[model samples]
Target chain A: MRNPLTEAFGIEYPIFAFSHCRDVVAAVTNAGGMGVLGALAFSPEELEQELTWIDEHVGGRPYGVDVVMPVKTLDRDAGIDDVSDIGAQLRSHISQDHWDYTDRILTEHGVDVAARDDGLEEGAGLGAGVLGWTAATGAPQIDIALSHDIALLASALGPPPKAAIDQAHEQGVKVAALIGRVEQAQRDVALGVDIIIAQGYEAGGHTGEVASMVLVPDVVDAVDVPVLAAGGIGGGRQMAAAMALGAAGVWTGSIWLTVAENGSSPVVTEKLLGATSTDTVRSRAYTGKPARQLRTAWTDAWEAPDSPGTLPMPLQFILNSYASQKMGATPPRELVGMPVGQIVSRMDQVRSTKQVVVDMVQEYVDVTERLTADLEG
Target chain B: MRNPLTEAFGIEYPIFAFSHCRDVVAAVTNAGGMGVLGALAFSPEELEQELTWIDEHVGGRPYGVDVVMPVKTLDRDAGIDDVSDIGAQLRSHISQDHWDYTDRILTEHGVDVAARDDGLEEGAGLGAGVLGWTAATGAPQIDIALSHDIALLASALGPPPKAAIDQAHEQGVKVAALIGRVEQAQRDVALGVDIIIAQGYEAGGHTGEVASMVLVPDVVDAVDVPVLAAGGIGGGRQMAAAMALGAAGVWTGSIWLTVAENGSSPVVTEKLLGATSTDTVRSRAYTGKPARQLRTAWTDAWEAPDSPGTLPMPLQFILNSYASQKMGATPPRELVGMPVGQIVSRMDQVRSTKQVVVDMVQEYVDVTERLTADLEG
Candidate 1:
């Protein structure tokens, strides 16, 4: 229970929970583990609201905010300065063929793509394209996060921009970057990032080819900073494995999706609960980069022979956002899926976020005790 | 240093070394770890010679033999009985287009495709198509293995055929199967296999999507038999992590490639020594199934847009064997690659097999002691 991460963060355990829901974040933080709220789905104002809610609910316990600041996004090359125009600018990059292919697949799946705008206004819901992935959009979210009483700032893709890292440092917020490669860990540490989350291929969102068993130790060896193990880690035994691999702590994502406070759609929750590890796949269909998600008709269509391939980065998300919106309205159970890890197999039951944290700590303790016993006897 | 695996196998350490070289196997066995010789590349006569050499060298120390008896193969559906005719029969099933594509890639790479038959006869060398993958080919290898003094018989793909399991058990040889998924592990154990090697996506050769960090504990939980953690495990820390995740031992492959006794070509050994974890990729280019190998120009060509997609199972291997043959005569340093895992990053030096085993055990002891201290203090 006590490690560099626990001692540094002043937490009861070294479990870091990443979730988009404010309730899950607050619940995990209140339960003595650090809860990191994902800021990708929310606008800057919405992120501020979420952080304010978490701040009030957690009663001043330390929590973190995770933002997607990818180094190789379309907007990086497009040179869009205005944050307001960023979404429209990125959307224009999506080819007509890609848009038509997505629509055709959705229509074939019985999703009413034509009737997608029946009730919801354009860019109203979670399907809003290019939601805070680029520097133009993510910078404001980082600014909003620093204004709050946040303990950590995590970049989901690449190194948080130098300016953002320096700003977080000025605010006494530790900056962490999620990297799948060892070289990326070195680069992130050089950029003044405090912690490196070595995410493996089994992780939920965007991931690298290396697995935690290899990447954790590789990152731990390459960097002077503390490295948090991410991807495919759900419970205490996995946490113990991460620690054994020299990780400071475990950064978990998918396990939180099915928790009682998760606020995920019941349909997605059911699918996650029923899924085995094999049910998930690393597909570029949604994110343009390989992101582990529940394999569905939607992913399959994009991978099919005749269908046009997915667009890159922000463009893919923009194009797929329409299908997501349509599916959200009609709820094509088969086409509906979420980014999840191979650990989805273990998220079988719905428990409180606090209960999940407690179980993980208990199991970690049990595993360590067993390992210690093995050493002596 | 002792666990259920060490006790069960009567070995000083629970480290399982897998290599195609008999010298590496014997050296590892004599060094107090169990070395399992990969029987895929050897004919029954060749395997007999290798095991005889190992028996002579190890002086009755415990060792194992690994075979590839995939439950699903082209031969399984093709109904080929004669082992000698199996190659020609399977070769015929490969499309002419695939043959041309493979030749074209090799020819474009400055390889002398026409001069392939200059020094090597067809089906004379390692590039011989369909090497002990199917039941017909692999069953003989298993028989040859059981005839030897191997302490363990390991099937690299599916569960060892029921007959092979019974045969090995009758001879007091433990049967182990390598699996990537939990369901596969369950199937393996249900088939009366003594041990399950839960290989993750980070492993060399054929692997499943699940990673060792996730797959190890998942398999350990699913089966009654003791599980050996494989893929991406090279050093002592990875072994400790695997044990922490509930594995009885660690089964390693990539690390042994660079050992002094490995007998790999100097070109491949040099590539492995210099390669980082990211340098290896899982591609079905060489094998019909996805196998992790060094990302050379050869693998890149298979992944290129102009190249035809790889064929399935034995057919792909059959087609690529020609390119492999041509490359063998005139070594293309950029085109030459071998099956390797992410742990290839750690194989930066040429240590003796004994030294590698000693170092791993020392590291395991150090890690366990550190964990114990962490718990106490």
Candidate 2:
């Protein structure tokens, strides 16, 4: 029961559940393993409210905050209030045909349209310009996290900037970065990252070029620090494999997205359940990064011949966010592709987050036992 | 150039260039990249003769022989020369319909028919059991190699058996094993394999479940021995990436398969030249192992609904060798899926093996210089 990773984090289990919902984070942390709230979708004030709620609900249990401080963002200086200017730039980047196609699709889906703001086509339903592109958006969110009882700060994108790392270290908070390459692992180590997450392309959400089964050891070798295997890791078998491959722990995301305590839309959960190993792709259509998502009709449309290729970072994200939300809210919802990985195939049923963590540990124990027995035999 | 790999082997270059042709082995060893003669198709006596000729031509530059020593052979104890017996067992394992379909396809393709040794089925060309299928087949070839000044014993399958490793070490020859997983690297270490070849599934021939980009570091982490990155590595950029990922060197197969020094069938060489990155598939149809080969009509046929699923290990290999041979001899080469990796896309034309190695090293230097400039800037 004494997970090395949990020991490292001073938590009950190595399970660091990544979630967008404050309720899920609070529930997971209270259940023992750390719940790391995803701060990419939230504004500074919204993140503050969520962190406060988690601080109250977590009952003094340790938790973490995840921010998207990608090393490469389209517009690093865009702020929330002044996003309209960059939003205008993004509008110019999008073509009229693309706009018409999006409108037609939303109308065909019977989505209730909000009245368009006349003065600015830039800051429409989506947030203003390049503000959504960079980690600056997460700066205030990081401040909110620092104010809470957060034990760790993880960057979902590239390594957190040197300043961010310094600030986190100053606060006595552990810093971790998700990476897909050995070079990135070395860079993270040089950047003084406490943990290197070698996430494979098989993982849900934004991912890099490598697969988890191969990336973990590469990262472990490139960095002296401990590595948590992410991507394609969902069950005990993968966890055992990761450990066998020299990972300190396994960091999973998709396995929790459809759990009983997950905040994922019901339609999205259903789609995830129906997906197989091949039912996902790395696309920048949803976010302006290579994210592994369920290969849905929406993803297919983005890949189709006629549609303009996806816009870069904030521009693409802004153009698609409202339509994505509407699609997430619909039935026969093949259009909306939720970020999931190859592990989606194993997410057959919904279970409580606590049960999921417990089962993973139990499964790990069983696998080791079986392997040992086989080796001895 | 003082290539470390060749120096390690007391050869010209570190490159252990794999080729089915004896002429290529002599040429590469003479030029630089130590040509490793593919002994799969050659009889023990023929292999000996080939090695003798290479020794005569390369002026003792340390050429080696490569044989298929698949771990999962048809019957582990089935003597390599017990062609009729093994063929009977292999045929029995496959259904009558499968055999009939195989026959029909071959006959349709204008393949010449010959009465099989057992006369159980009249199939096209010769029986398949004569080709390399087990360690038994490769053992004689190894013996032939040892009779020469061969410095390295490389296994195309899983880690060579303890006896093979011991035998090679006893002879002052290094034993190398190709691994696609971290656990396999550990297994190779426990088996006392002197070299761990972390070949990604993207590599040609029998590969495991991980890609090279991930496998190299994982292998490096799992073993103390020098690690070589195989799969998806063809040119200088990939070579740099492999070293960046902690590999001591690159073990390339596809790159050599197209070199002018390589005497690959003109048909096969052309296919490799024109192919793109997307033209390869990891299918078990060719060698009873998950090998990356050109996505050809033969591969399509093997995966079709009416076709029988491939048999396991040596049996599947026994059932397909004649077909492979016929494919090799044909024009426009239908049913001929040349074993290759994702790196095949980068192979645009045939060049001398030595020049290829030199270019790769030079390109690696250039790429590093560009990267360093970017870093400093």
Candidate 3:
């Protein structure tokens, strides 16, 4: 708890709660731990309003905003100025065979997205925005984040953009990036990132094959920066494990998804509540990247041998975004999932986010006391 | 610290050090933590001698014996009653194509094994004992183990046989089994295993895909029995994490390989000291089963395309065991390597087994003190 994360962020504890809901973020900060809001699905205007609301509610307590800016992306074209422009590029690149494959799976599940959408990109189920992959989209989001009195700016996909890093540093906001490998962590430190969030394969969303037990200490040894261990970190024992591996704190996302005030769909929450740690699989169907999600019929179909290969980045997001949300479908779970760590199975209850944070801190103290007794004896 | 592991074993600390060397086991027990001697490399007679040595030196300090009694193995013939019978089955089932492939790799690397031993089934580099894969071999080792006044009988690969568990309990010795998944832990508990070793993928030799952070808690939640955390556990912080995840103690193996009085070759120890966490790969090249080992040319060749696929256990082991040892080569590292965990990177120096135990306890105290100070503040 006396590590770099608590000291740098000026927080009582280093338990990081990652969620998209503004309420959860404000609540976690109001408690001892820090809250990080995921901004992938947010428009600049929407994100601004959300941050504005969070600032007012947090009572000057620190919170962070996470943006997905992958270093390797499909929208590399400098001319792409907007999400629509990226969508146009995406529509042009995805082949008919891929569409047929996605459509066949959706229709078989009873969604029939191709027929329902009427050739428009508009879909009812998808929340909002697409392709946070490019800097064109992520830059404006960073501008909005810097405008707010945020304590930290987190990049999910890869190293944060140089411009984003400079802007955050200039605004006195610490910059952090999540990495799955030791090489990426060294690169992040070389690029002057303030913190490295070392995520393991058991984590939700995009991840690498290395587990946190190995990756946390590996990243910690390879670089001089502080490391926040992510993936499969849900409770006090996991937070203690992170610190044992030389990590400054724990960066958790999946555990927050089941919290009472979470912004995720009820379908996801229900699936998660009944799930075990082994129920999650790393599937590329949700987005172009290989992200860990619940093993639904959707994930099984996309992984089947006869299915079409996934499109890269924005193209996949653009082609299957509507279907992914299963907008207006009678059954919500036909295509509803999000990135979550292997810790999903332990999330069987709907506790308040504040309770989750409080329990973790208290459990950490209790566990340490138990361990220290043996050490002293 | 004050959990089932200590209560069941009467050890001051719940740390369990797993090693093939009896000296290291004796040292660990003398240092307050429990030591477990791995019996995979010993014949019945050799094992008896080793156990006798441990008993004489331990000053009545309790210790455990670990025998690899996998539930399913390549040698499945119930009528086959001996190691030579299994060896005959192994020799017949192996294709010459495999022998030629193994020989070719060795010869090309300047390690011609045929001329040195004149077709004898022995080599200098691979320590000792050919097969620990089946009950045919492991039962005899267990018989030797039970003859000694051991405190515990631990099984690896799968659930311990009912006969073994019942006999151990009848003899007033506890039975423990190592598991990598929640289902395995439940099955072990149902079978009345005295303790569960929840080993993550970060462990050496045989392992499952789940990490310690996720697997430990999942297993802890599933079973009411005592649990020991293994894999990527070389120090105190990891011990605290295991306790947090509800494990009674930490079970470690790889860290002992580099200890001053270890049984492994100095060549392997030097390689381990110089290696990083990513330097290991889970390959069936050495043992038929996928055990993590130093990433060498032998492992790479077996894992690569355009090569003959690895043979099944006992069969593949009987055919190529001699060649893999690399009896004598100038470069030394032509094919020599040993089983190790991803925690190899942290073993930057070689210390006494007693010093490691002392340091771990000290570091555990330091970490908890730091965490508790913040919790109270």
Give the number of the best model, judged by DockQ: 1
- TM-score of chain A for each candidate? 0.96, 0.90, 0.94
What TM-score does prediction 1 earn? Answer: 0.96
First chain of candidate 2, TM-score: 0.90
Candidate with best TM-score: 1
Tens-digit lDDT track of model 2 for B131-167: 4555545566777777787877777776666776787
Clashes of each: 0, 4, 4
Q: After superposition, how far is residue A230 of candidate 3 from its true place, in Å?
A: 1.9
lDDT of 1 by residue, B45-104 (tens): 888998999889998889999988777777788887777666667777777777778778
Model 2 ranges off by over 4 Å: A1-4, A77-84, A104-132, A325-328, B1-377
Q: How close is candidate 2 to the true structure, as a TM-score?
A: 0.56
> How many backbone clashes can be found in candidate 3?
4
Give a tens-digit lDDT track for model 3, residues A1-377.
56556877789889887888899999999998888898887878899999999999998999999998877766665355666545555566678898788778877877746445554654322234464566567778888888999999998888777877887888899999999888888888788799999998789988876778878878987899888999888888787778766788889888988888886667777888988877888888777788888887778887787978787776666656656444554554746666677888789899999999988887777776665665555
* Candidate 3 Cα outliers beyond 4 Å, as residue runs: A1-10, A77-85, A88-117, A120-130, A218-225, A283-290, A297-336, B1-4, B77-83, B91-117, B120-130, B284-286, B305-311, B316-335
Worst 10 residues of 1 chain B by lDDT: B120-129
How accurate locally is residue A216 in candidate 3, as Cα lDDT from 0 to 100? 86
Question: lDDT winner among the candidates?
Answer: 1
Considering summed lDDT, which 10 consecutive residues are worst modelled in model 2 chain B?
A: B122-131
